[model samples]
Target: MDWEEHAARLADEVTDRVSRWREPVAAVPRHELVPRWWQQVAGEWVLRDGPCDLEAWLAAAYCDTSLVTSIGALHADHALGDEKPTGLPTSSATLPSLVVRFLRHARLTQGLDLLDLGTGAGGLAAYAAQRLGSRHVTSVDVDPYLTDAAAGRLARMGLYPQFFAMDATRAIPGTYDRIIATVALEPGRGLVPVLRALRPGGRLVTTLANTSLILTAWKAENGGAVGQVERDWAGFMKTRHSTDYTPGPDALLAHARQAEGDEVTAGRYPVLDVSAAWELRSMLEVTTPGVELHYEENGRRRTACLVHTDGSWARATAEWLAPPEVHQGGPRRLWNELERIRNRLNAEGQLPLYGSRLEITPDGVCHLSRGKWTASLGV
Candidate 1:
């Protein structure tokens, strides 16, 4: 198959919307970067080998969608045909449109040094290296295997960018004119290094973990950064320090699934999947961090579950649009907190998350303020 044709088509699709990234989008051979990926089938991860199915491979590679390359500790390239590892996605070839969106947010200019954090499949690195010289781009990931693999793939295309195997959240090796993190950065010490790595007046574009708010800030003379939460939103995996993420709140979720809580009451609102509702999810995360959300639907019956690491859990169940039956337990009322956010949204026309003014201290604490409302995240 002529993969260039698919690449051109993808360029047309992405560049038609984001015209400035047309050159890199058209030039980078995305198929070469992601040769194998994982696709969900019947709720299980099934490996898709590109070489075996050229047509399907080209379609997925050139499509404007994320292709998971690693789940848990398993990378698609090394997975056996029958192996189906189940866990959160650790790496992926992020969708091309979103990649372009992030680069656009950086406001790239010729000769500017750029750092592409979370170099999973090297798609972003490839595009950046194509636009800016390879020498001007630096890509880093916690997985050395990822950096090595991305380097090999990029070398094949005659695009060689600096690739490092390091946890950027802990320490960034070098400073750059622009730093764009595709991975989500939690507020706290992790963010401190990122802010310190930025040269004064340099631009930083990234998302905070658990929320879809895209934060674009510039380093200031005060050692802190100043910017606004863009009116845009994007979700990304949180930065991990190891091969696989530590165990999630599965035990709490299992409890939330069935156990009768200390407080059982009729919910004022109908059951809604907080995870799928971006605005509500962001608001809840800002107001109360570290809440894990899950939603289930069976025919007309719907259920939403919220689990926190502090042993707090909320379960709400209902049929279709009917008001939900809520159960809450532990130190905090998770469901009630969600309801309060929903109530505020109903009372006010909108939530003050997006388009809010952001003030980041040198210590990496973020303060978001809009009108009379204010919220802070990080240490």
Candidate 2:
């Protein structure tokens, strides 16, 4: 298989718009950074190493899509036949189109310094060097292996930047004309570092850590930056500190195990995965706190539970032929609350986070103002 031909074909696919930075993308061998990738197998994700097939690897790497290099911050580490799911990406190089879209936003000049966070596969950094020169760009990543891998990939293409292995949450070594974070920023995640990294009036484009929120704010004259959500939507893998996500043994498990009483109400809303709900899920995590949801489905039984910190709980379980019997306990009946919220959305035709206006305070509280209710978030 001719790998170079595969790479050239991909270059042609993304040619017209990327022409300015064509040499960088075309020449920098993508197969090097993602030498070994992951695939889900038998309810688990597994690794498939490369330098293997030219046609297949090219198709996978340059297909204009997101390749899940890591999930739940466990980067393709766990061995097969031993664990339940493992290897969430601590980091990754985002898709090519997303990278170029952001670069187009940057509007690079001949000599402007950029702080590229989450260096990932180093592909974007290489493109930056091509556009603005290698001396002007600085890339940072939390994982040393990732930074090193990116460094090597960039070196092979004869492009190099001040690539450093450091946490972006800490002090940025120097001020930048533009700072673009590929990783999303969470509320509890500090903002001082990013603000301090930017020179006054510096423009920053990044997504809110876990939500479908994209922001393009400029550094303010006073201290912080101010901006609003971008009309479009983009989501990245959540940042992580632990080796793997241990969301605890499902806080809702016990509630589901022993459900009973008239507190049980038969409800009728198509069950949704709480994790997929983003903003509302985060809001519930904050307002109610310490809550968790669990899912289990067999040929016969299907169950899900919503459990909270203050011991408030709700659960639903059903055999294949029957509707779920809902149960509740503790102070507030959580399931009842969920049903109510869903009903409200049905009446209103939308949920709060969808197209909701956001005002981020100087202290980093995200106040989502929409319609009648305004939610003030804790920074």
Candidate 3:
């Protein structure tokens, strides 16, 4: 199979949907960027080296799906078979369609300076360079190797966007007319640096970490940014201070699965995976941040578990549509909180998350308001 032909066809399909990004989508070689990736097989992540199987490589590259470029610090470059990495994905080539959608939200035009935040595989930056000139684009990531590797590949294609290995959550090197973050920013992580680095009147596009909220703001004259949550939802891997994700809630989850809790009650509804329910998940994350979730379905027995770094845990199990049996431990009764939020949803017929108004202060305080409810992140 001809990979170029496959890529061209993929570009055509993508352009049909995102008509504005057609040229860049057609020009960039996604297959080259993701020559090796991790694919889960029977609960273990295994390497899929594209060079070894050209047909499979074309198929995977052309498909509209994210490819795991790195698991923890163990990037596909150094990873081999059967050796399962313990942590979650640290980096990935986000699905091309979503990448185009992000670019669309950025409202790009020729000659505007742009920063492609989180240059994992440099796919977004490459597309930006292809649309705008290479000199107009700059890309940054915390991982040095990702920047180095992406730079070489991008240069080989005659695209030379400035690449930096720096923590984007902190100060960046230069200001930009537009900033688009492909990585998610954690709650309470203020947008001050991002706002400072964005030119006044320039637009910023990014998502909050662990939630499906897409934040789009323009730098205000008073050193802050004002924006709203976009109606469409998008999720990205959280930004990291280091190469791997922080140690997760493995211990909390382990204890929650088996240990008896302080209180046990029946759930108002069947066991539900909060992660799958974006609006409820976002509201819950806002109310109780830093929660990790795990869910499984075994025939009629569906189970949902929540664990937090603050020693809070909850387990809910149910059969089919029956109410769930809930167990709560630690300081918070998570299932009850969820039911409260769900009750709000039932009463209002919609969540306040989508289309909510956002007011970000100069010092990084993010105040979110929709109707009568309000929530704030940062001080």
TM of each candidate vs. truth: 0.98, 0.79, 0.96
Please report how far candidate 3 places residue 367 from its true position, in Å.
1.6
Residue by residue across 1-379, what tens digits does model 1's lDDT show? 5777788889888876557688788888899988899999988999999999988988999999999999998999999999979889999999999999999999899999999999999999999999888999999999998999999999999999999999888899989989999999998787898888888899999999988999999889998899999999998999999878989988999999998999999999999988778899998988889999899899999999999999999999999999889999999999999999999999997899999999999999999999999889985
TM-score of model number 3: 0.96
Cα deviation of 336 in candidate 3 (Å)? 0.8
What stretches of model 3 exceed 4 Å from their correct place?
none
- Deviation of model 3 at 245, angstroms: 1.2
Model 2: per-residue lDDT, tens digit, 78-155? 324343445345556577767766775665667789988778777778778877888888998777767777787787
- Could you tell me which 10 consecutive residues in candidate 2 have the lowest summed lDDT? 76-85
Model 1 weakest 10-residue run by lDDT: 14-23
Against the true structure, candidate 1 has what lDDT? 0.92
Residue-level lDDT for 37 in candidate 3? 94
Top-scoring candidate (lDDT): 1
User: Which candidate tops TM-score?
Assistant: 1
Better of 1 and 2 by TM-score: 1
Model 3: how far residue 370 lies from native, Å:
2.2
